[model samples]
Target: MSGYDIVKTRETLIMALKQDDEKAWAVFYELYAPVIINFARKRGCPKELAEDVLQETTMVLMRYLKNFQYDRKKGRFKSLLFKITESKVIDAFRRAGKISRLRNSELFSKATSEDHARIITERENIWDNEWKTMILRESLQEAKKRVNSRVFKCFEEVYLKEKSVEEVAEQLKVSPNLLAQNKFRVMKIIVDTAKKMIHNLEKS
Candidate 1:
């Protein structure tokens, strides 16, 4: 489901979570678990290990959930979650002996607060990109369901497939102007949906 489909605001979800609402926790997990798992896999963990990392990260988040405070100036909640996931990734690598010196290295062992912040910022960037991509994809899927099939097809042909407008118009047996209109209409829906999804995600 698109983030737009989630009715509760981020604050509401967090409040419910604090109250030990099972539904809220489930919704929270559904929203973020895939991204966390994908981040681990992208960082080179195998699928099985990635899944393990996700579990470990989720448990850590649950333990510390109540301590979280929403402060946009500091960062989004995803940034904190990304930090936890990054820690888990390091732990996984350490366990596998992939980075034998990481634990004793200056970066981890004697890092200044600034160094840790820089590392977290880098991980947050990766998390943000993945989250945006997922939201955009979900928004596109949601927009497709709401738009006319022909209009969506026009969007696919002109934007996604990069077909010449004239070619697509000819194939669709429609005037160039009509095809262009369809493409514009579908594009608008997609962009609007994506914006909404991003807004909701950032708030969350």
Candidate 2:
């Protein structure tokens, strides 16, 4: 199978990882390391600190994935990942003597149970947003490979580059109707692909 097919689903990759498949581990790291780094960066970590969190998170996963249980009814793989990355972020902060910064920031108040719950909820929201952004980005790349070059270009100009449909059509010398159709078709492909990607992680 192609690397894309092999790494397409989290469950499949996790199973491969459990068997100590080196390629599967590489694919897993390629897919998730950025997500962890970006999550840490959003939480105000510098690039160096974010890279530290990524390494720490990867080590934790390596130590745990041998027996990791992926029960969807219990929780999502993404959430487990988020929890791990979050723990690493906190640890990195502590090492840098910046835990007080997080506690004193707007996201945290007094460290009470209520505050702790609120912190999790807020941080989860941030994590989810970053995760979705990464998925959309990957989906867009896949969409480009699946669609016509012109169609993908139209979609990029109109949707991603924020160009008007009329302007793109005129520039590309295509009818506005054609541009709209291309936009809709590419959007469907991207959204569908993104949903499937999310399901691969969250559902199974």
Candidate 3:
């Protein structure tokens, strides 16, 4: 993610958590939950097991966010999420009987020694970040396309304006409750579409 994307996502999450906004939590889930599933699948988990792991991992995330630390200097939200993913992937693989042998349990061992051969970190591509930035940019564009100008503008007022959702609702003459739900709806569509676009871009 670019610096701006990271900052935006982090700010949105923090504000939502502060307000105990269920809609914001749901948006966050839509953006990240698929990543856990994909990571499990890549680590050789079966489809059912992959889904289970994704659920388990998300539950863990929910548990942590009550006390979760958002550290930009340490890395982007992607890194924190990926660290959870890496742990959950290993756990899923273990449960699926892929690594019963003791010596092969280490992350280093898995990357270096597995027959399917995960990419060693030393050789991992930097294009991943570029791809993510493109996807996020496109997803925001797609989200903007689906909503009424007023609804999209309401989202901008609340999220982009740093105004409270309550403030946005009053500005638009809509209910605050409705405004909050709309916030998540638009964000989810944009994020999911962006992920798909990025995946297609990578294939090309």
Which clashing pairs does model 3 show?
none
* 1-204 per-residue lDDT for model 2 (tens digits): 323456474547667877788888786666677788888999979999999999998888888877777666877678778999999998988999897876687756646898778878989998888878777777787788889899999999999999988889889999999999999999998888887777676665
Q: Name the top lDDT candidate.
A: 2
Q: What is the lDDT of residue 12 in candidate 3?
A: 51
lDDT ranking of the models = 2, 1, 3
> How well does each candidate superpose onto the true structure, as a TM-score?
0.77, 0.86, 0.51
Cα lDDT, all candidates: 0.77, 0.81, 0.62
The digit string of per-residue lDDT tens for model 3 on 1-204 reads 322233245345544644566766565555555556655666567889878877777677667678756554555554555666667767876776765764466753654465444453421222244336446755776678778887788778887788987777888999988898888888888777766554332321
Each prediction's number of clashing residue pairs: 0, 0, 0
> CA RMSD for every model?
3.8, 2.9, 13.7
Error of 2 at 89 (Å): 1.0
Candidate 1 least-lDDT 10 residues:
1-10
What does candidate 1 score on TM? 0.77
Quote the lDDT for 131 in model 1: 85
